[model samples]
Structure formats: C-alpha cells, structure tokens
Target: MQIAIDGPAGAGKSTIAKMIAADYGIIYLDTGAMYRCIAHRVLLQGDDFSDTEKIIKLAQEAEIRFEGEKVFCNGEDVTESIRTPLVSLHTSDVACIKEVRELLVAQQKKIAGDQSVIMDGRDIGSVVLPEAEYKFFLDADVTERAIRRKKELDAKGIEKELASIKQEIQQRDDNDRNRVEGPLVQVEDAIVVDTTGKSIDEVCAAIKKYIDEVRA
Candidate 1:
C-alpha cells in the first residue's frame, strides 16, 4: 500500500509521514529530498540553477539512496549536505521541471509498488501515487508554518530573519502551486487536515482515525 501525503512547507508532512511509516512498518520516502539532492548537486557542480537541461542531465546520472534517515548520492553521504540554505532556496525550481519530476516520480512509484510505503512531497498524491490507498493534504496558516519552520531551522543552528523565512515559504508555496507539472494540489479523494495549532499527537490521531475508517 502507498500513502501519499502532499502539503506546503512546515505543515508537518515530513514529521507525520515518518510516524505513519513507522507505525505501518513501511519504508518512508522523502521525495522532497530527491529534488533537494539535485539542487545540491547543481550547486556543487558550479552549474547555474537556470540551466535546466544540465540539471536534468545531472539528475539522470545521479544515484540517490535512502537508508532509513540517511541519504546517499553517488556513493557519497549527503544527508546533511543537501539541507543547506542554498539548496533549500532553489529546490522548488528543480522540483518544477517536468523531466525532473517524471524521473523522481517514476522512482518513487517503483519503490511504493514494492513495499508498504509512506511518501511525502508536493506531487505525491496527484502524480506519483495517484492510485495510493490513502492520501492526505496537510496544511496550516502561513504564519504558523513560518514559525514552525523557524523552530526547525533554529534547532539546526541555521539562523534567519522571520520576515525572510516567511517570504521564502510564500515563494515556495506560489511556485509549487503554480507549476505546470503535477503542481501541489489536493487529490480528489484526499483528506485535508489543518494543523495550525494542533499538537503532533492530535494531528496523528486524526490521521490514524481516517486510516482506520478507510481500511475498514
């Protein structure tokens, strides 16, 4: 079974996906990291982010592996490397390309087909796993999401102004929503969850309830 979770930034898709995957004893795929990995590679190669063809070629050659929480790219461990602010800033662009999305989505579909998997990203529900058994669109107020993102960055020792963080989040939202290929959207059968002020446990409980109902 595949569980597809799509959401805007800081809406707890990743956190919830990790939990649900563990609960279901399934492999968890962080699809966002796939784009981030490509962005990270582009930066490392000194290629311009606007060089879409080059980026696509790089993606084709790239070897990405996920072992639990560790991520490897081309035999090099990049779990920490890809999380840089530079890559984070440009990942939306990388994720928007039809070729890039197709490449990654194909890989995601293969993995999901082989195992019980929980995957999260902008297009998982709509494009990567349209026939998934369960789908969710997680969301929250922009300000709340910005604050949550700030907290996560703070924990990582990455400091930035709140205004700038909010701006970045909004920019990503706009790009993801307006992109032509598999833009971030609510799937037809998806359950929407607003987590503006809810605790993680509360949100998980609600999702679990839905899962039980769906499975029943």
Candidate 2:
C-alpha cells in the first residue's frame, strides 16, 4: 500500500513517514529533498532563481537519487549540502516552477508503482499521490513548528534566531500555498493530525492506529 504524508515545514512529516516506512519495511521517499538537490545544483552553477528555463533544465539534467538516508546528485553525496539555509530558500523558489514539479512528480509516481512506499512532502497527498491507500496531513502551530525547526538547525550547527526562523517558515508556507504548480493543500480524504504539543511517538502511534484499522 502507498502512504502519502503531506505537511508544511517542521511539522514532523519526514520523521513520521520514516518511522512508518521502517516499521513496515517499505520504501521511504523524501520528495522535498529532490527539490533541494536541484536548488543546490542551481546554486553551485551560480544561476539566477528567476531563470525558470535554466532551473527547469538543471532539474531535468541533474541525476538525483536516494541511497539509504543519503541524497546523491550526479554521483556526489550532497545530503548535508542540500540542507543549508541557502538551499532551503532556493528550494522554495525551484519547487514553484511548473516544469520542476512535473518532472519530480513523474519520478515519484514511477518509483511508487506496485510498491509499498511511504512518501512525505508539501504536496504528496494533494498532488503526488492522491490515490494512496493511506493519507495524512500533519500540522502544528507556527511557534511550535519554529521551535522544532530551530532545534533541527541547531543540531546541524546552523544557528538562527527563533523569530527569524518563524518568519522564514511563514514565508515558505505562503509560497507553498500560493504556488501555481502543485500548491500545498490538505486533501479532503486525508486524516489531519494536529501535532502542536504531541511527541513524535504519539504522532506515529496515531497514524499507525489508523493504518492498523484499515488493514484489519
């Protein structure tokens, strides 16, 4: 069965999706990392973000792959490189491009066909895998999400103030919601999980409960 988890930044979509995939022994796809990899490539080439054609070409020509927990681009391990704040900003821009979304959505679909997979991203449930047997939309308050994001960046030694992180996340949410191609939205059939004060295990267990009900 295919599982699609969609959520905004720092909403714990990735963590929960990874947990589900591992527990079920299925493939886990991080669709956001694909866009980040393209953004990283664009930055390396010193290309302008407004250059949509160039960005689309770069996305098409670049080879992006996931090996275990590592992300590779054109035979290089760029797992850490793609997570930089600069790439995070550019990724929002790249993800808005129509061609970029089309290319990545196709890739995601191909990888998921006839396979049990858990995929997470801003548009996974709303756009990429609408027919997924199980779908979830995770969300948290802005302050809570900012705190979670700050903790993540701190672990990476990338420091930013709480206010700045919250503003950046708000901008990202606006961009994702207003993007022309595959805008981020919660599908009607998806189960919404508000994770504002919940622990990761609590969130995972809630989702797993639903999955278990469906399986039974």
User: Which predicted model would earn the best TM-score?
Assistant: 2
Query: Model 1, 20: alpha-carbon shift in Å?
Result: 0.8
lDDT of 1 by residue, 1-216 (tens): 789999998899999999988887889999999899999999988949889999999999999999889999999999988876678789988888889988988888888876888899988888888888899999999999989888878999999888898899999999989999889899889999999999998998899899988788
Q: lDDT per model, in order?
A: 0.89, 0.92
Weakest ten-residue segment in model 2 by summed lDDT: 83-92
Candidate 2: pairs in clash: none
Instruction: Encode model 2's per-residue lDDT on 1-216: one tens digit a residue.
Output: 999999898899988899999999999999999999999999998958988899999999989899999999999999999988788877889999989999999999999989899999988887888889999999999999999989989999998999999998899999988988988899999999999999999999999999999999
Model 2 collision count: 0
Cα TM-score per model: 0.97, 0.98
TM-score of 1: 0.97
Candidate 1 off by > 4 Å: none
Candidate 2 stretches greater than 4 Å from native = none
